[model samples]
Target: MGAMNTKVIEAEYDYVKPASLDEALDILAEKENVKIYAGGTDLLVKLKMGADLGMDIMMDINGIEDLYGVDKTADGGLRIGAAEKIWNLETNADVIAMYPILSEAMHLMASVSVRNMATIGGNFCNASPVADTVGPCMCYGACVELKSKKGVRTVDATEFFLKPGVTVMEADEILTAIILPAPEENTGAAFTKMARVRPDIAKVSISCVIKRDGDAIKDCRMAMGSVAPKPLFLGDISAELAGKKMSAALIEETAQKVHDFVKPIGDHGTTAEYRKEMAHLIAKEILEKAWENSGGELA
Candidate 1:
């Protein structure tokens, strides 16, 4: 009789649950190859796939109280704790009333069960090009607050992502919260996407925010995902559309501008040409909805 040899899987790395933000920061500053663990929805999958992340220790910040709530800031903006679950934000009273565009994107991501396990901070930190939340957050003028033992610093969400699965976060810094400014009086925002199915990732997604003054647009902001290496915030194009009256011809021109500017990469999910077309289509729909919400009638 012959005996066969089999491979034994061994779990590597140590796990730490810090009691406070200070403790977490201290560990992060001192530990080598430290990876922050929040919801683990994305990180765990990467680890299983043997992504060369160089992680040797996983620091879980779930127990830190400061990283766990959705609160209103003094300036009427919302400060969302890093460890707050997606499900919490999806149903939070203030989040729904104040930033429903963000809620709309969150509601369309994954499934209910995955939402329960995913954290908003984790989503941003993962830096997926197709991350649903990033575009909404970008449209709303969000900022990310990062803390380490040294001190705390903030960066605009528009400047957060460097590329897919990469952010500007330093090794010792932890993303503590996401700060979203209050929507202006005349402003309205909306998010829409085209996906293979309800639960699938978007082929192209757009989030638009606009401010209307009588019959003319006072300002415009738009962000798109799955059409670039990172979420693309169309600042120049938005500037071009500002003060323009909303009309079918203008919308067509805006869509054309979007298609011309964005160069998305093709993958197994879709072709680059198809994604470019959908980027235009989704942007038009998002802009129309946002304009209507701002009390403008589509022409």
Candidate 2:
């Protein structure tokens, strides 16, 4: 193989690896053109792929004490530290049992080795159109906690991504943690992805969360990845299916609605039309599986 024609820029930043969130935020506020480095799984790859390198300061937050644990809040929601690895999320028994959508999504990401180093925050912060975590996180109604030198703020996952490679995060704010609400009683969530290869990034991915009340659906949330510029919530279809008994016809109808709502563009991985078709198929499959797991009728 020959050397690729990619520009290499020399590192010019004063590296600061902060041990605390406050310290990291302070550095961010004080430094000019500072970029936060988490696992660097995505950032480093983008840089190698010839992404623009414009930062003069690189602040490493992986060692920050305030952003390195997985615990439950007093209200019983899971609080995942921003620095927690995707592999840890895949294997965590509590996360597996309670947030199967997240577990499945994490398991479907790159590979075991990559997941071992990729943090959830990095996945969301990178804001890739096909990010595995975004779909599941949106379906679960997860919120991102961001901190700056002044204070902290939280934003829902559904609203985090503004466009491909863009988020609501400000330059001086670091994502501190991800907050996932506890699953409701009699609820189940599932995620499905389609790719040409087992470990490749998803061409189209869907995550469904359903809550059952007797034979009827009490709530349903569906999110799709890689089918739009950013992760999208299928709110219209969700509302249409709410309070309805699960059925093949209803599932197919809602799936079509979701398919119609998504606006995908042709890319190297897959065609736009193929993604549209897969989006419908994957959404139906995940919704049906979630309904069945939650003790709802599948017929």
TM-score between model 2 and native:
0.95
Residue 289 error, candidate 2, Å: 0.9
Deviating ranges (above 4 Å) for candidate 2? 1-11
The candidate maximizing lDDT is: 1
Tell me model 1's lDDT, rounded to 2 decimals: 0.89
Candidate 2 collision pairs: none
lDDT of 2 by residue, 255-293 (tens): 888888898999995899998888888878888898988
Name every residue pair that clashes in candidate 1: none
Instruction: Give the worst 10-residue stretch by lDDT in candidate 2.
Output: 1-10
Alpha-carbon TM-score of each model against the true structure: 0.95, 0.95
Cα lDDT tens digits, model 1, 70-132, are 888999999999899999999999999888889989999999999999999999999999999
Candidate 2 whole-model C-alpha lDDT, 0 to 1: 0.85
